[model samples]
Target: MKKKDLLKLPSVSEVLLEINDNKYHNDKYIKYIIKDEIAAFRSQAKQGSLQLDRNQIIQSILLKITKLSTASIKPVINATGIILHTGLGRAPVGKKIISKVSKRLSGYVNLELNLETGKRGQRQEHISALISSITGAEDAMVVNNNAAAVLLSLNELAEGKDVIVSRGQLVEIGGSFRIPDMITKSGCKLVEVGTTNRTHISDYEKAISSNTGLILWVHTSNYIISGFTKQVKIDELVELGRKKRIPVMSDLGCGEILDLSNKGIPTNMIVHDVIKSGSSITTFSGDKLLGGPQCGIIAGKRSLIKRIKVNPIARTVRSDKWTISLLEETLRSLRMDSINDNLTLSLMVTTRKELEKRANKLLSVIPTKLRSNHNISIQETFVEAGSGTLPGATFDSIAFKISSKKYTPAKLSDKFRNAQNPVVGYIKGNNYYIDFKSIISSQEKLLLSSIVEVLG
Candidate 1:
């Protein structure tokens, strides 16, 4: 506690040697971590902000080292009912997709090689046919994400020209990405054509000029604009583009390939439907509705796709083999008509009865006494498809509400997050909720253990 005692703390060399005995592979990294912890403790001692006995110095150093060891990116359970939670890594992939992608990671196997001709091949060729077949497009290519795809399309088609877009569709979503900003960055002039809530086809007709290079229709998937709203349809825009000889493009931000209308969840323009609507090009995110890795898919007519593919920006925003492999596997599963498929998005859109069953099963795993500790109950809840998809739409789900007498909602949330595999949930007022919409059946046991550990 005294200055003299602080001066007698373990030397850096001694602490480094002690840590070296723990079998740390990198001596330099361990030595740096040990020295940094010691400096902080010494600073605190000088300022009288804290006191540490000489005997506790080694233990403190060990704790700091242990904390650093576990500070890597590890997987956590998602109980937040947000199927596409951006902060928690948008969509979850199955083990089969993981294994298939893992195989492509080690060494190499025809990543850019054509097996039939035994020559160098294009990387996009691997998934191009699958995407075209699934989306009914003449051709398709991929970029790193939807943003990149938009940038590439705009730069390649409308550079130094006019891009007509609706004022309502000039949206800014997560990560500060705005349509006007992207248009400016693409070296194109943005010609706003419609009002915020309404844009008639005549607006586009008036905006068209000799400089009009592209017509962009952005699907406001992140938020809803309703009540006296009128936007030009893709078919109408495509008809106009056909007459004017200008390319029509649609940005289906969270485009889905499957039809979920039967599940009571209304979906917007599907990728294939947009392609069939005669848009010259359509772009969407692979991670959101497709339930694949983070990538951007651009599908449309063969001529437009060919032009976009040869653009120099396409090479910079292209997807790597890891994304390509997982995407290929995901598309294959979607194409199959099997009933026992394990798609992540499909599971998130499961029926209310199925979610209630999963919730009850999770509750049954927790012992009766532990359940009573927090006064847990199975409550009907609603959750959104997070990360800017289906903004105002919420799906029916089951949530286990816990009201702890010993701890408030905040304290209980902290406890759940401190688990080995952290559990994320939602809290409203004084109650903490773990929704069953995003929690898979295999995670029920782990969720039960985390709940019991927190409340018991």
Candidate 2:
């Protein structure tokens, strides 16, 4: 097989036919997939040490095509105990409710049309009532994510004007996405008020001017400033916004509904009681603490919401009907008092007794030989609700620190990580902990079985 001839890939249409035998991609999607795959192949072969046959190249292409064709947005168990693992497609929706979304997604039914009046109605109407009632926002608009919500607000309301943010709150995330960068992109001037460690009400007060269009209070969502730190309170900031006659726009980046402290859960309480607070707007994610979809929700005064609705940027950043429809369903579930039962976050934060039950369930299937003379015991351990939600917060969770007879802690941990369903865990002082809080109920047996299989 000539290398050049081998490199000449099959027609994407032909490959598509081989994979599905019925469904075919539209010309544009086919072109994009093939172009991208071919580009990747060429880049990989640039080292010149690699050789590709026509069949091998075709196999590679077919694998990608098949993966895409049968894509169903499947669920994966979060064994890392990061309750809101943003990277692993944050917030897998509840099975039953997401099933509803999937069914409706296959066909369009009145996305914008008002069924009752036989006229056009705002798509935002679907979620408006639920979001307002739930979050106590007089009005709300949801976009792709929290960042987009923040961007949309700034672009619409503070464009070509000064937006004052705390130097303390000007934090960066995974991709070097900075608060200043977002503010700059929104056509707003970034004014840093206080130092990263400590920022006071006086710092914000000193920066206000006619150009100061928005007093941006971005939460230190992921990172925390420890001792010797002082920050403005949400209510105090709302008061400052009132005195300055400027809108206070806050980004509660992580999502939460019920106060963690009130729930007797060891998590921080930072969500501004915004519905009752006389503030212009507040934004937060639907996934993090809310345990909902990855959506950015903006809720605040009706007047400010009206302005945001009319903004040109909204069209670009606003979510589709599927997102709103699913969110509405989730919100409706909450209104009906079904959210606590259905929510993953609630399921994850288990009592010590509940944790013991789950651990014992897994232990039942754990192989005898590796169970340290068959006397393996479940012990209580501190499990942090992860992915930057609560830094120091610890929840009582149960896990088996497999005191093994056969394998070392590191070896056992590695085995589970490579399983069909990855069971991520950590070890310290020769103890391996598979936190019950992280693994799903269905996954418990699988985890135990995996350990047995590895030992066997």
Candidate 3:
């Protein structure tokens, strides 16, 4: 084809005729491709440095065509059974809440307006009371993410002031976001105290000078210093702050407000109790253990919270309509007395017997040939309530281990990852470990089909 001829931005009808003449099967996609081609051609009307329009159009169309033909948002069997699988968008929102969001998104409602009086109402009011009721905090506010919450808090209180923190507590979470960097960005002077493994209250006390504005304690949620580790208690710091007339602020990273000391969670990890620890302000995430939308929630003395709210960055880092709506509903769920049954994390932490039933259903449906090719076994597996919530611990669960002759672990994983809905499972010891903790009963059939297609 000549340059100008190729540049003739094919119309829908012309494209259809060419495909028909060539006996191409995909006429349905030509309409969208032709539209993209035309848009590309017109946008390059300026004297171009390179032939940009002609080259990228076909490639863009082909990519879009592939995506359009493929299953876009189909559900996958979560045999990996990670309750809070961060990669899989964590907890699935209830159908009721999802429908509410759909209805709200379709048009505008009083997202910013109070329907009762026609006056401008606080957006946080949608969920604040519910969160307050559950946590017993005087006041609370939310931002886009936990990092933003920490940034906003540091900027508000300790800007250009010495913020005392434990050396071990200066953590680097996912994506290289370090605590010291956050403190620097917020204009706070870093005052590191004690050793990484052990820090006494006296170390914190010694660090406090007239410049000490806030004491920051960050949760080492992802790491554990098991042997010979001691740190000042949150309550102790709260007491110290009271005595010294200084404010203690801690970042309850991976914020779970539940009293998990007895719920089989690790020791002394309660957000509310820590909040009540005389800390003037407690900042945590709305996502993570909370199983809500990604948000940084700060709840504490109304006066300090008010200052943080008025800071200019609050407007910049505020939650959007969808996040606010989902978070509000999720907080409401937590406040209800009957919320235990509905909790997503709690549900994923089901016993092995629950998963065994689903596994047996899958086993019955799978073809005999594939089953014979692999040794299937149910072994005790542990699952993390991921999203950085529960670290160094796993819930007791069972998984289906399939080791095959025809396909290797990598090949099987690749097949599932590229399948219609994309299944993600772990491969350990040359076998695929499909944890029952993550899988639901309804997904058993699809899991069987996927296995059959890969190994059938």
Across 129-246, the per-residue lDDT of candidate 1 in tens digits comes to: 9999999999999889999999999998899999999999999989898999999999999999889999999999999999999999999988878999999999999999999999
Model 2 regions lying over 4 Å from their true place? 1-74, 260-262, 270-272, 335-340, 370-379, 402-418, 426-432, 452-455
lDDT per residue as tens, model 2, 307-366: 999898888888887788778777767632234545565665557787687777677666
Quick one: best lDDT, which candidate?
A: 1
TM-scores for all candidates?
0.94, 0.82, 0.85
Report how far residue 374 has shifted in candidate 1, in Å: 1.0
lDDT of each: 0.86, 0.74, 0.76
Model 1 residue runs over 4 Å out of place are 1-9, 20-23
lDDT of 1 at 76: 73
Model 3 scores a C-alpha lDDT of: 0.76
Candidate 3 deviation (Cα RMSD): 5.7
Clash pairs (backbone) in predicted model 1: none
The Cα error of candidate 2 at residue 59, in Å, is 9.0
lDDT of 3 at 290: 77
